[model samples]
Structures are given as structure tokens and as C-alpha cells.
Target: MRTIDECRAEVFRRSEEKIKARRRARVRAAALCVPLCLCAVIMSVAFMLPKGPRTEEDMMQEDGEAPGGASGTEFSNDLVGDGRDDDVNAPGGEGSLSVSFSLTWGTYGISSYDSATGRLVKATDATRPEDYVTTYRLTDEETELISELIRGLDIDRYPDVYDPQAGKLGSDPSMTLILSVRMGAKEKTVTAKNIALTYESEDPDGQLFLDVCREIVEILTGTEAWQSLPEYEFFYE
Candidate 1:
């Protein structure tokens, strides 16, 4: 049903559309190259182009010189673990002592020591350095013994060490250790209950405080003071 002239006209129309599409593609390609052209100009102005590959021989002459060479920080990867020093049973000594009493009566456990001959007492009942008050709380006998320990501790060295509630015991205000790390010259105080907790905490780089108390306990309670000691350990079980 078609003639040669009509077919020829349709062919000419398709050719025109293809030519327009090719021109549009060329225009888009030129647009895309515009930014590339700008970047090329920037690089050209920034640095001189290299003439050729520079081998080791070309770099050999400049080994000793640099533009602004400066030293960089270096670190060692050799460090391991958290401990800085690990040595026990060395020069440092340790000790601890505990006495049971009541805070309601305003009396707390007392201990005394003298390094001169290395003597320690619980109370001074008969003005004897060896004998100490056994029952009465803060009696003249106990006060004398406590005073001696206070003097030995170097009041000038341990201020603000005692706590206000140190010798405290039962909630009844009668049973307490009364160890107040505050007051006095170089004094640190703690109740018998707290003494146990402090030694257990043994914090800050290792038991330094525990060591000091251990020495004091050795003086006051003798070598076997803790042979039959009792402590509560489990909270849930």
C-alpha cells in the first residue's frame, strides 16, 4: 500500500532526528569537560611538571638536605600490663588490731604502743606500762593507754585522718569502734568494724594503710591475736 516516494520521505525524517540527538550529545560532552578544564589549569599553575621518572640515582645527591625536615615523636609499644612495681615482703611493714566494746557508753576499743622497747597495752589500770584496763570503757586506765598510742602516731603527721563517727558501733549509740581519722596532731582513728573493712579494701597501689595498721596490731595484740577471729563474709549465700 506504500509508494517509493513516501518511504523515502520517512527515511529522511528519521535521519534528521538522529542528527539532532548526536548534536545534543556533543553539547553535553563539552559541558562536562568544562570543570575538567578548570582543574587542569589549577594543577598546571600549582607545581612544575616532572620531566621523567626519578630513580634512586637521581635522589642520591639530596640525601643530606631537606626543605623543612623536623623530628617526629616516637613511642614505645613495649609497655605491658597495669602494674608499675610488684614487690611484696620488702621494707614496708603491716599490722592491724581490733577490740569489741559499746558506743552507747561512750567507750571504744583502745590500744597503745611504744617502739622504744616495743610495748603495747589495752588500758592503764595500775599505772603499770604492761597492765591495761580490761572492762571499763574510756576509764583512766584506758585513757592512759590510748594517749600513749596517740603520741606514738606523731600527731604532727596525720591531721584530718580521723572520722567524726569513727568509734561508732550499734545504731543504739552505744556499740562503736570510735575510730575517727580526724582531730589531734597526727592522728587517724577507725572503729573495729571499719578497721576490718579498710584492710579488706587495701586500695590505691596496694595495702599501704593496711601495712601501718598491721604493725600497730602486732604491737598491741601479740602475734596470735587473729588466730580465732570471726568475720561475716557472705551477703547473699
Candidate 2:
């Protein structure tokens, strides 16, 4: 009961359906491949870009503030401290021996001491005058000890002493020492840099400079002076 024409038409209909299904599958594959290709291209472009130097603005933004808030000049000053200011002396000719010091980096303070009256005065910032300067009278024994130590350190002999690492970019300087001596009509001053003998050197005598400076600091501001003003560390700039 099958006719040839009817069977032929049925075959044609099935072939059309097969062709449509293949077209649909191809469309789906193309859609999927397009996004994947685009994503790969984007990733490649990102990798190809070069990295540049970090700017001050970028650093400030990362720190969550504008410049000068903390990580800028203001913060540097805080770390350095406030101490170096003009001398607060009794009179021009009163000071017989005076010693002062400052650091290129780290804790900042500048102080001047007079051996004549055992008077020690310090200031942290030059711009702002000190509200209340810390003062202490060096004991007679301490004064004699300082004089002996100074001579032992040979500070006078080396008026412009410099460490081997001086002037280098990363040279570590302990502190800049300024010593002035007024004896009769003669007045002499010595400035020494990188005074700390932190590293071992062939010359054993190299340590005398640092030792003398440390002794001076300790004797000048002993426990009594620090106990009186707990904020002594912050006194330096």
C-alpha cells in the first residue's frame, strides 16, 4: 500500500531536518568559541604591557592620604626629631668648652653644653623656639671625666675626621660631633662625621671616637635628668 511519490517526499523532509539540526549545532559552537577567543586575546594584551616606576602620588594614594600627611616630609622630620636650635648661653664669653651633635638620619637632636657653669641646653627645631629647655649641672667628677675622655679620643688632633664611608649614598653616619674649646685668646672647633665605630676595623684606635661620644651623652643626661623629663627622647628633632 506504499506509493513511490509519497515515499520520495518523506525522504526529502527528513534530509531537510538533518540539515537544519547541523546548522543549529554549528551556530552554538561559533557562539561559544567567540567569547573564549576574546578572553584569551585580552589576557595576552594585559601580559604584554610594561610596568613603570611608582610615583609619589601612587605611594600617597596607597597610604590613604595626600602628601605631607605622614609619609611625606612631615613624617621624615618626626623620625629625625626636633633638637638642633640656636645656643641658649649665659653670655658670649661664658662658655669655656661646648659640645653639640646632629645626625644625617634617625633620632634628631642638637644640644650644647658649657663646662664652665655645668649648664646643658638643647633644642630640636630651629623654626620654633623651645618652650622649656631641659637643663642639668654636670658634677665635678663628670666634668673631669669628660676632659680626660676628650683628650683620649684625640678629637683635637683630627679637626675634620671622616670615616672611610663618608659622602657615600648609603653611608651610615652615627652623628656629627661639634666640639669647641675656648682657652685664653685662642678658640678652636672640631667637627667629626661618621664617628661611630660600628664595624670592625684594622685600626683598634678607631673606636675611641664613638666611645667618647657615647660617654658624653650618658654623663650629660643621666637617669636623674631623664626621670625629671620622661619625654627626653622626643626632644631631639
Candidate 3:
């Protein structure tokens, strides 16, 4: 029943088993499409790369510089959200006044003034206030009580100038206060942090900036080079 040369050798053995089952189904579809096309080319080169570091809110959205430039929180949205200064209450006295304090058990203080040397500089030093120098002049009732306590504080309503852990406590000691003023060419500065449990918290505007930094640290420790360093005290309470 079969023989025409075994029916052409059973039609060339069923065309060589259908060409080796189509070359083993194209080598199992190229080994399953080359690892899924190399995992989609390594996820398209990891989403076209480029991104790592630059936070601090991306440097305040790239160049509105906060985080410690001009002592941080860079200024002027009409001097902190329209709290208004009207050019620091314009008047005749043209510029210059500074105040500083630094601590963490080393205390470095400074107070300055200048209406072309009308004089009022109470400098202080640390390592337990063991260094000093003082000066005074300007008597128009102490230059109108140091220009009405530096224009009655309200430092642009202080909403966080540099809160490096807002007035931390229990690190043995800590404190920092700095205020600056210069009317003519316009300069303004404010920094505070007198962490004694940040004034035992109850924030009424951070206890009115710790009660105007304890009346400017009692007017720079009531000068006379802090009363000739009488056992130098004022260890930030």
C-alpha cells in the first residue's frame, strides 16, 4: 500500500519534521525576546538620569537664598510679610547700629552704634566673660533709650529666621541673638534663639522673642564692661 520509493521517502520524512519544528520555534522566540529587550533597555536608561543633591528646598527654589545667607531667611517681602518698616521709621539719624551675642558656654557679645561716632559700644567677651572693653557717650537720655529699644522690636514678626532646632535645650548651654540696623543703604538683621527650653514654651510669639531677648540682655549686661567683670555672669539663665 506504500511504495513509490516509499512514497518519496514519506515525503522526505514529513519535510524533515517540518524543518525541525521551525527551528525549534525560532529558538524559543529568541530566548524569549532577549530578556524582554534587555528589560526595556534598562528602563530607558533609568529614566534618562540626573538627580541627586541640592535640597534646603532646592536652595529655596534655586536662588531665593535662605538657609543662612544674610543670617538666613533672607528678608524683604516688605520686610517679612508686610509687617511694615516704612524705611525703618524714617527720621534724621542716618544709619548704623549693631548687636550680637553668641553662646554655648563661651559667650561673645557686642553692641555698637554710629551716628558718626555719637558713641555707644559695649563689647563683652567670654570663657566666662573674662575679657572686656567699654565705651559710652551719646546722652540724649541714652540716645532716646537706644532708639526706643531698637524701634520696639517686633522683628518682622519673627516666623523662624534659622531655627536650627528652635532654641534647643539641655546641651549644657546655648544662646544666640543678633540684631542689626543700617538705615541709609538699607540693612536689617535679626536672629534669636535663647534655648532655655525656648522659654519654657507657650509660644505667645515665642514669648515675645524671649521678652525682647531679656531686654537686650539687660542692655548688654548693663555695661561698664559688664560692671568690670564681677565674676562675669548672665549664663543665659
Candidate 4:
């Protein structure tokens, strides 16, 4: 009973209804995502907020004042730590085994190496010090180095111990050793000595020395081989 024009209009109306329904569904889907997006934004903001910086209120409280006040800090240093600082026992004396060591390079300078990290590094303490505290890369190592010195030897196989009154065996080689060790200490003064071991060899053994020293430092100080001064105790300049 309807005209062709009327039928075409009905078809177009149906199409319009379908389009509207689709748009409504899309709006609902997008609405579902809003809460999740909002939650993510809130979490991001919370994570980025600064945590360590002191607030104005905190600062005021710390300064012992309100509003604007001069900031203050309280800190203290241990003039003396543990009994270790009070005594410096000699190397061989009874109940006196705490010792620090030093190496004298003169122009050659000291070198250090680290076995823990397998990293061999060098120290630029090229300028020698009047008094420096050093350690053996290893206690066993120190024993070896010291024993070797006592025997008058070098890194390479060379025997240089002198007989004093007797004639010296081999000629002087390339370099010399400057070994100074603090064996023990008293209430006021500590006991230390220096031993110079000359070598009949040449060539800068910086890298070799560094590796050896690093090991020694590790043994004596529980660190690496180069000794600066008193890493732990109180001492005079």
C-alpha cells in the first residue's frame, strides 16, 4: 500500500538507526578504557615523585625553627677508633703483629694491580713520599717478598745478598728496592725500618709492579697494593 518513495525513505531510516547503534557501542567501549588509562596515569605520577628531597616543613624542623631559619647539621668524627689506633706493635714482637708497608720507587714510582676484579690499574704517585704505609698484596706474598729481600733477590732469578766483609758476588743490575715497613708501635712513637734492595736489571717495570702491589694491598689492607699513608690510624704529617 505504500508508494515507492515512501519505501525508499523507510530503508534510509533503518540505515540511520543502525549507524546510531554502532556509534553508541563505540562510545561504551571507549568509556571502558578511561578508568584503566586514568589508573595508569595516577601510578606513573606516584612513581616519579621525589622521595629523598627534604620538604620545607622538614627543613624548618631540622633547623630548630619555623618558616625561614638557618639550616644546621650535627656530625662527629672518631678522634680515635678501636684500640688499633692506640698501639703500633713491631713486626716481630710478641702480641705485636699489626704492620703496614711501603715501597720506594724513587724515579720509577709505585704500581698496583687488582686480582679480585682482574683489573690491573696504575697509581700516579710518581712523586715519592717522605713516609708512606704499604702492605703485602698477600701475607704469604709479603712473606715471600720479605724473605726474598732477606735473601737479596729480585723479581727475576737474581741473588744479591751481600756478605758485607766478604766480596760482593754479582755486579749491580737495573733498579733498586725501597722497602719500608711499620712493624709495631708504642704509646707515643712507632717502630719502622727501610731496606733498599738494588737490582742489576733495567726497563720500567711499572705494569709488573702495579699488579704485584695491588695484590699486596689486597692482602694487607683487604684492598689493593699501593700504600699512601695511614688509611686507618692517626699519624703526624
Candidate 5:
């Protein structure tokens, strides 16, 4: 019964109401989506960020060098103790023995023994000897054996340097051996180049030097501490 104008007006009103409902639906959807989008963005940014400092075990697991060209494990001088033990200087005292051995070539290694505390420190891959080091304790019997071997070397009589004669054939040495020993007030250091070649040539001094080096190497390598260390990555030819 309505007039045409009323019919038209009613239809227009319905259209407006539908449009408004659609706009309200869109607004509600946007409100919900905004928080979800923000949360997603925050999570993505957090994942992209760098992690914190690595732990020692993590560093070691990677087998990578630590900062300052050191091993993952920190080295402490306290592990070896201070050399202030009075017995170290006393003649015939329990602590009057100290010995150090080193081998250098493409690779480097060193082992030091101190009687004062029966402490033995060994380092390998000694590109930086102070970086990676391990400590062990020596039994009294082992200590006495080392002391006996060093004394038997008559190391004082050995020349400070042993270089092959210039004309000596087959003397191309590829490595160097250094031994330092201190007993009470007496100390001696011997440096032998091409020690292996000399030892093979049946030189008395070289033979003796290699013998002592082998003995020390045997002792150091036989310990559990040495076994626990990472294997040598490089070697001398």
C-alpha cells in the first residue's frame, strides 16, 4: 500500500544498513588481526637476533679456537703453582728437581715437571704454548725416575748447541729438540737441531738426547690427562 517514493526510501535504508554492517565486520576483523600481526613480527625479530656469548663447553664442542688464540678452556697459572717453594732451592730437598722438554718444527709441544708439588704440565699444538695446557701429578717413584734419567744425561757436559757439520751429507734436519733441567743450584739447557738425523747417524750425544726425549715422551703420553686432550691436528714431516 506504500507509495513508490516510500518503497524506494525503504530500499535505500536497507542498503545503507547492509553497508554499515559490512564496515563493522571489517573493523572487528582488523582489530583481531592487528594483535596477531604484532605478535608474529615480534617473534620473527627475536629469532633473527644474534645469541649471547658461547659457553666453554659449546666452544670446545665446535673444536674452535677461543678468543686471544687460546683454547676454549681457560688457562690458569695457579694450576702449576708458584715457584716460591723453599724446597726447590734446597740441595737434596724433595723439591729441588725441575725438568722441561720441548720439540719444535711444523708443530710445537712442551712438557714441564716440577718436583716441589709433583706437578707435571704438558701442552701440545703449542702454536701458543701458554694457551692450551693440561696438568697432572707424578707419583714419588715416577719423580725419582725422572730425576735419575736427567742426572744420567750428564747434560752439563753437552754443548749448548748441536748443529750438523756443513759438509755432513744426509743431515737435513727438519726439527729441533730443547731440554732444560734444574737441580738445586745447577741448571743446563741443550738445543739440538736435526737431532733425529744425528741419532740415526749413531752420534753418541744425539743418541743420548733422543733416548732422554723418548723417555719423557713415554711418561707424558702414558698419563690419563694427556689421553684426554684433543688429538694433534698438525705434525712435523
Candidate 6:
């Protein structure tokens, strides 16, 4: 019973309602997707960003602190060098310097030099200073040379122990070397186990430690008293 105009007007109103409903659905969908897309983009950007360089504190935490509570600042190959010099008598005034080197494996031995006593003692098959196989007095020049070498070395930069990958080398027959140096009241001792292997393995820290040990050993073995001592009876593989 409705007129044609009324029928047409009703159709137009129904079409407008359908269009508004579709527009509301699209707005709701867009509102839901906008935050999700932003979150995804933020996460991707964060993941793609590069990390910053490691600081000295990070390295110190990883490698641990050096002997005498020293920081790990100058622990590099440039600081540690092979102990060889054309001029053994480098000019340096003498002070209260004491150095000792001990090697242990199949046999035990220790070599010690003291500037106060002007005595160098080398003992084998014994640990005490009283049991010395060879003893010699160091001249003023000899003491100065030793003092120069010991003072030149920054022993505080070295760790107390140098053993690379300790868990893997447990079964192997390793030789332990202990070097102790005292300048005035300050003293530091460094112990290395199988340092040759560590040197060969190319560990930077271990290599530096080995170099310091070599410097001390060179100072000890290069002496006339050390050269006069007899060879070892037992050998270690």
C-alpha cells in the first residue's frame, strides 16, 4: 500500500545504513591493526640495531683482576716483550729488590737473588733457602742490572695464575712455574702452568704472562751462577 516515492526513500535509507555499518567495521579493523603494526616495526628495528663496543670494565670482569688488586688496563703484547737486550748493564740505581723463580713437575727447584744480602742461591731437590747447591755473591754492577730488569717489568699488570683452558689440560703432565718479584715493599707473584702450551695456543693473556716469565727466567738463567749449576736428572714430557 506504500507509494513509489516512499519505497524509493526507504531503499535509499537502508543503503545509507549499510554503508555506515561497513565504514564502522573498517574503522574498528584499522584501529586494531595500527598498534600491532607499530609494535612489529619497533621490534624489528630494535633487533636490527648493532651492539656497542665492550668497555674496559667488561674486559676486566671477563679476564678478572691482576695481581695485587691491579686493573686489567695494559695487558697486551706491546707491554710484554722477549727478554733480550744488547746492553745488559742498563744504568739504574739499585734498591731493595728480591726475585725468585721456582719450577716444579717431576723435580722441584728454586733460584733466588737478594740485593740486600748480595747473595744468589740455587737449590734443587729442596724448597728451603738453607739447602742450596750453589751460592754466589752478586757485585754492584750485577745487582744494578737485575734491578733494572725487574723495575722495567710492570709485574702488577699480570694475573696471579695463567692457565688457558684449565679443564682441558688437567690430564696432561704440566710443568708449573712460579715467579716472585719484590721491589721495595710491593711484591707480586705469578704462577703459570704449561706456559709453553699457552704460548703456542696463541692466547693473548697467556702469551703476555709467558713473556713476563721469560723475562724473569732470562734474568736468572743468564747469570754466571745459574749457568754453573748441574743439569736436571729427571725429565718431564
Best by lDDT: 5
TM-score of each: 0.23, 0.42, 0.22, 0.21, 0.46, 0.42
Where does candidate 6 stray beyond 4 Å?
1-123, 126-132, 137-152, 164-172, 197-201
Candidate numbers sorted by lDDT from highest down: 5, 6, 2, 3, 4, 1
Per-residue lDDT tens digits for candidate 4, residues 185-216, read 31111111121223211322322232233234
Candidate 2 regions off by >4 Å?
A: 1-109, 126-129, 164-174, 194-205, 230-237
Those runs of model 1 whose alpha carbons end farther than 4 Å from true positions after fitting are: 1-107, 117-119, 124-130, 133-159, 162-198, 223-237
Candidate 3, residue 102: Cα displacement in angstroms equals 14
Candidate 6's C-alpha lDDT?
0.47
Give candidate 5's TM-score.
0.46
Q: Which candidate has the top score in TM-score? A: 5
Q: Once all C-alphas are superposed, what RMSD does model 6 give against the true structure?
A: 32.7
lDDT tens digits, residues 1-237, model 6? 999999999999999998897566445434533453354445445654447888888787756755444552322122211222221222333422234223222112244544444455564444343545555555556454444443344445567875643434433444456656543333567665553333333554444344444444555567787787666443545
- Put down candidate 1 lDDT per residue, 1-237, tens digits, no spaces: 689999999999999998896566434434433443344445444433457898787687445345333422111111110111121111222221112111210122334433322333443323452434222223334333333333232222333333223333224222223323222122244433333333323232113223334333433453332222222122211
Q: Which digits, one per residue and each the tens of the lDDT, describe model 5 over residues 1-237?
A: 999999999999999998897566445434543454354445545654549878888768557664444443332122111223342333545733444323322112244444444445455445665544566665556555555455445455567776423224343334456676654334566765543343343555455555555556566677787677665544446
Model 3 segments more than 4 A misplaced: 1-162, 168-173, 185-187, 195-237
Residue 29 Cα positional deviation in candidate 2, in Å, after optimal superposition: 87
- Stretch of 10 with least lDDT, candidate 1: 75-84
In the order shown, what is each candidate's alpha-carbon RMSD? Answer: 37.6, 36.8, 32.3, 33.9, 34.9, 32.7
